[model samples]
Target: MWKALRITTLLFVLLGVALSAWRNERNATDWIGPLVVAVYPINADGSELAERYLQALAVERFEPVSAFIAAQGMRWQLPRTVPVDFRLAPRVNALPPPLPRDGNVLSVINWSLRLRWWAWRHDTYAGHWKQVRLFLLYHDPARSPQLAHSTGLQKGLLGVVNLFASPDMNAQNNVVLAHELLHTVGATDKYDPSSGQPLHPDGYAEPAREPRYPQRYAEIMAGRVPVGPDEAEQAASLQQTVIGAKTAREIGWLR
Candidate 1:
């Protein structure tokens, strides 16, 4: 009976979150003030480098996210700044299990349950249940050379950013972080999942620009600079990226 009740409660919570996310997506012009996002660090590899990287992290490192949103909001003539206040929270010892690559519904639900269990065990949502939360799993390149893929869920106010623990990777890390941040706020990925390339027009920053072979900046959702018809490169930094019209619309920065 207890197990059944727990499953029922989880389903209710998921339903509520799904409804909330749907409403938030449709109400594009509603600005409910600055959204607070808490970022929790996790030493995925249990390496000294990962520990040191976590120790050195500061809220200032994510300030660019706020700046980027403010800039885009200004362009859309938003009533006020769509500010995102980022807070660096305490670290978690264990990482959540990997998400299913197949992305089936049952697999996604199981993944969410496992992730929720980990978050509850670590008190990740204890004080900030109302605010958005992000779990950043940092992997030390020296220990694990393979890059860790990231994920974010719109229904839950949570995300997992898998990144390397290095100062040189900070810029790129922010780009990935920002992209996942938008994902939590109902922004969909604009890139081609198969090729990992930005789709034409919607993913292109300057879609209307003449001679569009070479793009000066990347669409934040796309996360790549299109150099040609069949080739592209990752934006070195967030400075070279912009929230495009479609993305701005999706995220409620534009009407």
Candidate 2:
């Protein structure tokens, strides 16, 4: 009887987490109110440059992300003017769980569970449990020019973002942050992972252009603008990106 009771209790706990995750995702993409997001900054490399940048970090640096979502929401005629609000949380001293390097599904699932537990422990923001959490790891550009690919899990409504720590990189960093933020709300990437090139219609911001080869804007999820049939470049900032119809649909901004 005790063994059976333990199994039942474990099942109940899993069920509760699943239901809570479902509600969070629904509320976030419903377009009814502002989706609150908490960003936790961390020094990716124990470097003075990264630490200095984090010291001077301000919420204002993330305004462009909030503004970008609001402008796009207005364009989509969302019920609320502001679709999402990005709030900065206190800097985290400890790092999150290291992502598994292998592609084993079980390993990934285990990491996700551990990450969710870690997030629960470090959530410094005082809010109604509805806020999505994003942990940003800042690396000094001189030390680590390239960052690992970011991850966003809709299941837990959380994300891990990699970014460069520098004033000039704010715009670029915001672009990457926004992309991963949407991922936590069910937006899928429209780019080919192998080539890092934006896909055809769904990825192109203005797919109906007379000549699609040289597109002017990048679709937010696609990550790049198609400058040529086989060439694409990263968007410098949100200004050069747009929420395409498919992404809008995925995020529930469209029917």
Candidate 3:
């Protein structure tokens, strides 16, 4: 009898969590109001430099992301002027669960559940109703020049972004964060996984531009500027990127 009761209670809790997540996901791309994104900075490297960077962190540091979203929303002629409101959450003391290494489906699902539960425990932002939670794991650029891949789950409305903890990297970091933030709201990558090349037409910022060998701006979801047929370069900042029409529709900025 005791074992059966415990199992029933667990199932009930899981059901409630699932329903809440579903509701959040449904409203994420509605474009009715500015969605609040609480950015939780974590010291991934555990270095003195990373720690110091966190101490001086401010909401202004992430303004580029919010600004970009607003600008895109205006371009799409969406109802809301400011599409996203970014808030800086208190620094998280603990690291999140490590992602699966083998890329197995079952393993990935397990990690997703673990990460959502972990996020619930650490969220401390209170200014607004946080529609999305983004955990920015900061590392010392000198120690780990190349960071691990970031992840964003739409169902859970959460993202885990790897970033370099340096003032110089802020622009690049905002571009990365913006990409992952859109992922939490049902945006898909427009780049070819193997080649890392932005697909033509859909992935392009100006597919119809005359002499399109060199693109002036990158489609935000595509994530890189297509300079030539065989070459692409990462956008230095969100300023050099635009939300393509496909991405706009994916995020419900357009019908």
For model 3, which pairs clash? Answer: none
Off by over 4 Å in 1: 1-29, 125-130
- Estimated TM-score per prediction? 0.86, 0.94, 0.93
Model 2, position 240: C-alpha lDDT score? 99
lDDT of 3: 0.91
Candidate 3, residues 1-255, lDDT tens digits: the string is 999999999999989988887888888877777898899999998998899999999999988898999898889898787888888998898989999999999999999989988998988777658899999999999999999999989978999999999999999998999999999998999999999999998889999998998999999889999999979999999999999999998888888
**Number of clashing residue pairs, candidate 3:** 0
Flag regions of model 2 displaced more than 4 Å: 1-10
lDDT of 1 at 200: 89
Clash number for every model? 0, 0, 0
- Sort the candidates on TM-score, descending order: 2, 3, 1
- Per-residue lDDT of candidate 1, residues 146-242 (tens digit): 7767887765556888988998888888899999888877788889989988998999999988998898999989999999987889998888998
- Name every residue pair that clashes in candidate 1: none
- Name the lDDT value of residue 216 in candidate 1: 93
TM-score of 3: 0.93
